[model samples]
Target: MVRDRLSWMRFCGLGIADTVPDANTLWDFREALIKADALDALFNELDRAINQAGFIPRAGQIVDASLIAAPRQRNSD
Candidate 1:
């Protein structure tokens, strides 16, 4: 989904032509977090912050973003 979703790619700070990490890289990163015993803490803090911000977590929601064409500005040197 991230590969095809502009919103997801933007949220991940990846441009359209950027290379997304494969499953093995993600798994290795997760394993490193697990080894460091930070996964639960990371998620707990994220959940806490989300709830504090009054965001209700939902699943299977499709998010989209649109790009608006803007006029190019010219500056005098």
Candidate 2:
């Protein structure tokens, strides 16, 4: 999935010169966080901030969607 979204990721300043971090890098980062015992703390902080910001959904559904288009192929008669 990340490979397919490389352009969007680069646009967000995640990588440089058409090169994005591979799956190993992401896995290593997650492992380091787990070893440091910070994952729970991180989740707690995110939950607290979201609740404080009044983004809690109430009795309604939330949907996220995106659209991507591909170039048309040339036709040969």
Maximum-TM-score candidate? 1
Please, what are the lDDT tens digits per residue for candidate 1 over residues 1-77? 77889999998899999999887888999999999999999999999999999999996898778888999999889
All candidates: TM-score: 0.63, 0.49
Q: Write the per-residue lDDT of candidate 2 for residues 17-51, one digit (tens) a residue.
A: 55666889989988999999998999889788889
What is the lDDT of every predicted structure here? 0.92, 0.77
Candidate 2 local distance difference test against the native: 0.77
Error in Å for residue 72 of model 1: 60
